[model samples]
Target: MSVIEEERVRGGVFKDINAEDEDQQPTVIESLCMTCYENGSTRLLLTKIPFFKEIIISSFTCPHCNWTNTEIQSAGRIQEQGVLYTLQVKTKEDMNREVVKSDSASTRIPQLDFEIPAFTQNGSLSTIEGLLDRAVAGLEQDQPIRKATDPVVAEKIEEFIQRLKKLKEVEKEFTLIIDDPSGNSFIENPFAPQKDMALTVAHYKRTPEHNAALGIEVEEEENDEKPGSDLDTMRNEVLVFNTNCPECNAPANTNMKLMILYVVNCEIWRSHRRAGNQNNLTDPSDMSRDLLKSETCSVLIPELEFELGMAALGGKFTTLEGLLKDIKDLIVSKNPFMCGDSSTADRAEKLELFGQKIDKIIAGEMDVHIILDDPAGNSYLQNVYAPDPDPEMKIEKYTRTFEQNEDLGLNDMKTEGYAEK
Candidate 1:
């Protein structure tokens, strides 16, 4: 039988083979070594790992150059969701744990702030220690040349290499993260059947960008009319769509509404139609609401003359207080010049006052108007009184302007007759 055919047949048929039996070893095929241009022996072993899928392990040895190489390939189909493996390596035993790092997996050392990006290395079936050894080897390989040409750069690399070497001592705790969009990477669990306290495994749905990178073409669901029309029909019903949680890249669903508007007032006052509350916007403490501000949405505070545009704070699902705090952080905490010498007294004073006003709004100490103008109509504010109109809050829906539609990329969207294009 041909080597390929025999290999397949061997994989299908299970046999009780003893490790000590030399005669039962799989036959090695003679192959040409690309590097030495000499005949080498190549061995392919098809094996199933315990509690894991089947994998093909291949080894190549070229006697002419004394060159040896090993690699692994998964025989199983790709998983439906991407996986992220976080391992805390605190002890020597942790370094000995086996890891299956696929070519598409990115390895990150959080403490070191170092990352080995995906596709930079080939698939490896190695222990944590072995992985580090291979990395050191790679770094050392280019060092001599670097030392001769760029001594300073080489010196820096040598220092970094030393730091990586010290990690093998297990003197300090460190975290190793393996993120595989292909869902093929794995880090062995020492305590099988029982969960490892130091290890965290998360499965996430691949984003549209990830799908594109993986050469996946996603077809949009067929619709007869504009999506807005469908949403209008189902305005009363809560709409759920697939989305990944920002904090943890886990697969999650975002519940939203298309046209439901909430209008609220603290006092018993009847209101005619108003775009937003402009005067004495008192806190409706009873109306504690959850807010879902989509990335496409904009926040407007006319009192402060502040307009937070799209993509400022990515899609968030939080309490009104939490949302305000995030806004404060974005404007104050995250701004480098807010406190540093780079900021002038006048600028600093303005930001300080602005922050205090936001703080008051968050504390419910001040009465100020806040508006969420969502062009895509995905932003939501909770109505404590659902199934009935909120006496205090006003929810209004308006057609987006040409500029808003263009900004939201809706101008290029062909909701109807898209299949023809």
Candidate 2:
């Protein structure tokens, strides 16, 4: 009777979580093209926003190509939630209020068909007047912004720009609206109301889609199992991992997954007459699988249409990240040190530096190329749609050497004519 007591209190699991990895300082170096790795023409822009207390802006552009990408990251700790602000600009004084706009945030003027759309440029920290000036600058640089060529509409567009500039100097009626899904955007809200009209400030719950667009969303892997069938069936797109999960620190498969993910098989076909030199039985499956697994070849990662998988990091890459991590790791084995002395150590130092640059790419810290150069022709980047891979990926096919042919057992000469004596 005394031993009949059991207790239950808690219902679900309680979890302890750590903070996310802070963003590294904006980095710039001579880097290859993201769409076409033909030239190292990409540049990274990092600047601290002036008034947005502890926020930084990072952007990417390839002067040689048509690639423009930008992002705004908080230099401070994580925000608990996001906020939105709306201001009715009826007088000139309202234009001087401090404003914070992240790269993903969208700005609008309902009265006029004018807005600086989200993800357009490196995010800016400026007053309302400054933002308008930026918008004007953008239009001038862009040669293809279609507008109503009709005289009336064209004149109106020009008038809108003019009003935006005179926002601080002359009193006018316009609505300055800012919507930031990241909660990083802000309009000056002093504790004391200085005017008869107060700024409308609201805090709202951020949806998953909004979080993803801002690069702060967290996700767990659902189906990471080895895929079957052709890896490149969907336009040659697949995530090829060289290291374990970069975010989760998952264990590496050590290239075990390569055999099943194949494009073409290379094999030896013995001559019917060269019975003395060859074994009687042949297996195409075995040869193909062997070609995929045994041959030493480079893997080429082209510019992916989707964000290359970054479940390891909380935020995903837009255009600056790729599968360069695996490519760089593969480089070590091929880029060996020749047996020597001081020269070898020097080479190792340079290689280490090069690897560091590659790591930046895997972290989405910068943009670069992923090149795998294996002479065997058996290795592939897996799931490449075209022979050229992406616009930037480079591929070279070499004639197999006599010794290489012999190693693969392809040197048979006497099917109907000549056998080596």
Candidate 3:
């Protein structure tokens, strides 16, 4: 009879490990929004794409009514380690006056509800399978049970199998369900959630008695600031306009209306519309009309508003022609362009170059539009050359030949022959 030695695995069995010890907690993901205001209403829109394992938080504050709101959304997954979540909230209020109806004044207000969705990620079964393989190996190596007669070995095997089954069931793949606050479910991609999920299971080699002796505490740091503060800083850094008071000749409050108009024209409108050349007019006539149209443009100061009329042909025009005049006027008014003031002179000189370019466009020498807006809302300048028309003019001449007979009407006595002489 051949005697075979039973190989003993040194590592601990499945019963020795704890599943909770191997599990990892979920993490929060953040998403931020880009915001803007137009008319009397504010708009907040998402700027970046959200992914699994991250969260997004966006907030907006209305300058007109002092109303504020915030939105948050989550990004899912980090590794096979943690899940992600997100939240968003919004608030709005009306800022209008009351209207008189018959004998009473009634106020109308609007209400708005702001809500965003929640995101999640669940881990895969492969992770559990890995844990099970390790646990099973440990169990088989810890005890050598070749015979069913051994009660002690039989009991250990049974227990190992039971734990393995439990782990297998728990480790099956799970899906994350995302929904808005209103209970509406969001669609998952490819017939499933787009986010990747994973689970981290903790394995403790020691007994529960020994594991209880350890203590763990995790603290996360906080670093969030008010949303509108940055915007406020940007607003403050922008330049504002000031002019002398016509009445007292003293420096008056900065013209807020004009400043706002400047800001809108220089910053917002130009930026949005991609207006190319700042100095070039698409249609000189229309340009003049726009300059004088009070309704077309509005200047808003804190408490005052300026309704400027359109630009006229002669009155301090700032159109291309006006700009040229302004440049000349500035040179004369300051007398610095001709002197040793090289910087002032340089600006004035550039204005002349610009004026020449504009003249060429107007003279039909250039084929391209003199002014255009870039995608970034900055003006662009371009020059195009076109051929002149034909010089010689064509003319046509006509001559007529007629035949006539000389004869008297009622009393024609002698017939006269009037031949061509």
- Candidate achieving the largest TM-score: 1
Error of 2 at 49 (Å): 8.6
Q: Give the Cα lDDT of each candidate.
A: 0.70, 0.46, 0.27
- lDDT score for candidate 1 against the true structure: 0.70
Candidate 3 residues 181-236, lDDT tens each? Answer: 21111121110101112211111122233223222223445435356755446544
- For candidate 2, what is the lDDT? 0.46
- Tens digits of per-residue lDDT, candidate 1, 298-393, equal 677777777665555678898777777887776665443443223457556766777898888877787776677776677788776788976756
State every prediction's TM-score relative to the real structure: 0.50, 0.35, 0.17
- On lDDT, the leading prediction is 1
RMSD values for the candidates in order, in angstroms, are 17.9, 27.8, 36.8
Model 3: CA > 4 A from native: 1-250, 255-320, 327-335, 340-369, 372-421
Best first by lDDT, ranked: 1, 2, 3
Stretch of 10 with least lDDT, candidate 1: 270-279
